[model samples]
Target: MKFLYRILFDLNKEIEEEAIKEGIVYVLNYYKNEFILYIQAYMAEARWLNNNYQPTLEEYIRVSTISSGYCLITATCYIGMGNIATEDIFKWLTNKPKVIDVAIVLCRLMDDIVSNEFEQKRDHVSSFLECYMRQYNVSREGAVQEGRKRIVDAWKDINKESLMPTDVPRPFLTHIINLSRFMDVVYKDKDNFTHSEGEMKAFIKALLLDPMKI
Candidate 1:
């Protein structure tokens, strides 16, 4: 954790160097607040676990979406985006824009869907599946089936948001969309990220060795 803190602290210099506009420097302060919120999201989940609290689906989504780290990654990605990421763009993202919101949701759901069982076995906090099943009085499979439906809907929302005309640059939106897509691929069939030695490694190796015919 200390190493992580040091890296985050060092990012101030890096971000300042990469940022050109004076307003971008001011926005860096705002991003620091985002960093705080990110940590708070994780702390909230820890508190829930410590108290043995079972969050409602709404409550779970509110926190887990932030805890998913997609928003933070989006912010960090934007901070270094040279000039396209202007002050207004940074402020807009800080407001939790719809495209980023849905991406965060998509990521959290996919992660929980694939990792819930393993986490449950380890006596971890209640995941979205458990919360939904408890509230809706459904079985695990039923909750998962519903969850899959939500995932499909999330993809639709992502596409709609990205494709529609907007003020934010297409490249910035691409970062959010691509992050969600990455989550889809990583957690679709299994938690390949956690077990990266298996499918993840093989996929990387193949990608590096194989050339695209197209």
Candidate 2:
């Protein structure tokens, strides 16, 4: 198990560097393959969980495999972004050193969304992706605009009351607010983007090896 973990870690680091030099196309493809593998493993675990009997060794292996996939995906994102501290994040991603910190926070939020139990809630992956996209802004008629404001406003109010005034930037706070709204749509939607076997293979190829068009 340790050997496998080490191998995955090393492979992830190499892929992360390549993806960074490439582009979002490569990153997206890489994540898609990882996501598919994890989902398959998760399905096995879900079946085990639904059975009347206790989990067997095989079931445990399935769960662990799923978890390893998740860990690799998370590591890839962190490594690709250069894994700077929250305070120094802005500097790493920007010339003026201001965007990195906010990007870090956004990455954390994205991680949370991915780790969330959306499958249990009967939510779909496309919905979650849409929610992540909306983290940048809010719309008036969308799902998030309906009731997400309350949760976001309350969180902001609580933070304001508890933290020092200088601890949080207004722009960052605003980003969180928008992110909250986007997540609402994700949590509520059920439709997922469907891909054929060929499409999936193509996505993997684009992500893992095609540096020219990453």
TM-scores, in order shown?
A: 0.90, 0.26
Tell me the TM-score of model 2.
0.26
Positional deviation of residue 87's Cα in model 2 after best superposition, in angstroms: 13
What is candidate 1's TM-score against the reference? 0.90
Whose lDDT is greatest here? 1
* Model 1 alpha-carbon drift over 4 Å, by segment: 11-13, 20-23, 207-214
Residue 103 shift from truth in candidate 2, angstroms: 17
**Tens digits of lDDT, candidate 1, 1-214:** 9998899778866776666443556666767778788899899999999999999999998988888878778888887676667788888888888887777878888899999888898757788899999999999999999888988988999999988997787898888888887897799999998989998888888779775667
